[model samples]
Target: MMGNTRELPAPQRGDSWNTYECATVLCAVDGCDHGACQSGPFFVVSISLDEDKVATTIMYSSDTGTWSTPASLDLGFIESDISISWMHGVLSGGALHFILMHDDARLGVLKYDLGTSCLSEIEPAFEIQSARFDSHALIAPEDGQLGIARLSGFNLSVYWREVCHDQVATWTKSEVIDLKKHLLASNPMISHTELVGSVERTTIIFATTNIGTYMIDLKSLRSKKLTSELRLFNHPWALFPYFSFYNPDKLRTRSI
Candidate 1:
């Protein structure tokens, strides 16, 4: 796994009000990792509080090393309606989707359109029946569709957006993998696992517990242990593309 740490600068006079405060409150430790995205370039998306108005702002860097001015969305989101998930967002179909934990105990998918600079919310296709400990992830798999995984009990409920081009996407049940039926006998610790990351297009889910990290094949129901050392800390957002592992410049480019 790749590890990264960042330091926030002090609030400046011309900066947005609560710029430092929100960065401190929302991005404590690895929280910023959750709000960030990287493709050909890097971009950081953040919610900023300015004069009591909460607006989303983004700073992006291209192949060039310099960062552009922070751009804020014209509209604002409700502070009480949706709580942002502290997981790295899935970028697909020209939009970035962040998992939203709603006030009514439902998961909301917040999509920020890069083309239109619009923010919209999509309710989860299914109710959240899993326990609080059960993990949820938004993935852009190799098929170029938006995927969601809910690891509840002994099964992982996989949901996919079947029609990706529609204004209102359609989500359908993909598959349910029963982990306990396959691996619990070998490692009881599989009972308590959280999704940390995945290898895009590889059809493998990377999960970790106190014991170590393991990869489960989405099709074969087979799992392979990747690490055996006990994790000192678990940062689910501590993931970057392996192809870009050696390029610090790309990773450093866009951070909100």
Candidate 2:
């Protein structure tokens, strides 16, 4: 078992992204369970138990301070999977979306909706499988819709969800960009690659090839080399700035 870190506070109402501050506290969970993604605004957190059960803590923050409490969530189908990805959940459409891995190696999404206070699983539009343990992510694209990006061989494919008023969302393939041709043009030593981060509301996807970091534009199918001085091929993680969707004037008047 390991010790918990100090409580991570949300940004202050009027504080700048670089200057916001919140309180901190010890966060100890039973039996060293796993925790995933912090949903924005309400700041809900999901923790999975050793026995496939899942629970959540709804966090509250303001200029005054930060606090959390147990929240009632229906963690549907959380136990049906073999394992959950360590990747942080993506927040879109009023829910925190997590990528789930089945025992057979198929991938699906589990959504915890803050507004409805419910948890549900959304299957991919097609069979999205990974021979690797973790190789996919749920992204909120520039269109403000939920989509999944998967890496297969040297190609990256993105699919978006098309919602029907009274029916389940239908997934459609929106883009398929070949990374091998683009990366080979810049570096011939490129071999392995993986999706790292999706930024600009996912209009851009950052990936690490065998030689360096690269970015792909979903709209134009253009690719660019970000850095070639360092070999970050094995580093599967990245840091991305928070996406702010508020007006500056109105944000100044609100409390964190």
Highest-scoring model, TM-score: 2
Over all chains combined, what TM-score does candidate 2 have?
0.67
- Residue 221 CA error for candidate 2 (Å)? 2.2
lDDT of 1 by residue, 85-191 (tens): 66666666766777766455457676767656676666667555233556777777656677888877667888887765556667788667877775576677654
Q: What is the lDDT of residue 200 in candidate 2?
A: 35
Highest lDDT model number: 2
Pairs of residues clashing in candidate 1: none
Mind giving the per-residue lDDT tens digits that candidate 2 earns over 1-256? 1253335564333323332111111122322212321221223254342333443424444323554443434444544544456556676765667676667677877676656657667878654754454356678864659888888778778888889998868888855677777778777888877777676356777777667777777777788887764344454554443543433444445468
Whole-structure CA lDDT of model 2: 0.59
Off by over 4 Å in 2: 1-46, 55-57, 63-81, 129-134, 228-233, 241-256
Residue 106 in model 2: lDDT = 78
